[model samples]
Target: MAVFLTLVLGSLAARATLADTWPAAIACGLALMFTLTGIAHFVPGMRRDMIAIVPPPLPAPALLVTVTGVLELMGAVGVVYPPTRADAAGCLFVLMLAMFPANIYAARMPDPPASMTANLGLRSAEEAVYLAAAIVVAVRGGQ
Candidate 1:
């Protein structure tokens, strides 16, 4: 997901533009993506899967999970505004880093669901991609 996001945004950014609309589009896409994912997290069976990904010691951290989801949703919404998109992307990057522990935990845990391993590897790569995208957006967004 992150990798895909990065690729899409990077491709868009490579072009010359007279307006900031490209960055705006990138921000809007990211915001929508995160907002939708956050919504999915609250669906009935989804919570358990999320808990499983977190460290065992934090298994029941419902509040923390909810807060993170809200933040993700908010960040996405915030990114759509031209005045806030760059900062919002930066915020999203920090959020991405903050939530990475859960992914690492899931990857290292013994025998996660059959699909978990593949998902973890994919997400790890995705994170790298998103990081690069965020950097690009941050550096070139205001131009």
Candidate 2:
């Protein structure tokens, strides 16, 4: 969720502000994406899957998982406003970093689920791309 949000937000922020720089489209896409995934947080089956990914170091895994979904909702809303885009992207970037361990832990699980990002390499690439995109969005959004 964080990676996808940051990637879309950053991609928009990287472009020029003078024209229709595609930020609006990307942001909208991200908003939609997060909305679906956020909803998934509440689904019992999905929640179980999420529980499997929670890192032990985190004190409140369940709460942390729930809060992340809420944050994604907030990020989706924040990315829609031009004045808030940069800050939203920056925050999303940090969120991605924070949640990365979950990806790592999940990858290490035996018979890790059959998701496209179930492996360490794929998850790492996903985070890397998202981080770059977030940087671009933050840098170009204000221009």
For lDDT, the strongest prediction is 2
| True-vs-predicted CA distance for residue 100, candidate 2, Å | 0.3
Each prediction's TM-score against the native?
Answer: 0.76, 0.78
Off by over 4 Å in 2: 1-19, 114-116
lDDT of 2 by residue, 98-139 (tens): 888888888888766554267688779767866665666667
Supply candidate 2's per-residue lDDT for 41: 72
Top-TM-score candidate index: 2
The C-alpha RMSD in Å for every predicted model, in order, reads 3.8, 4.3
| Worst lDDT 10-window in candidate 1 | 10-19
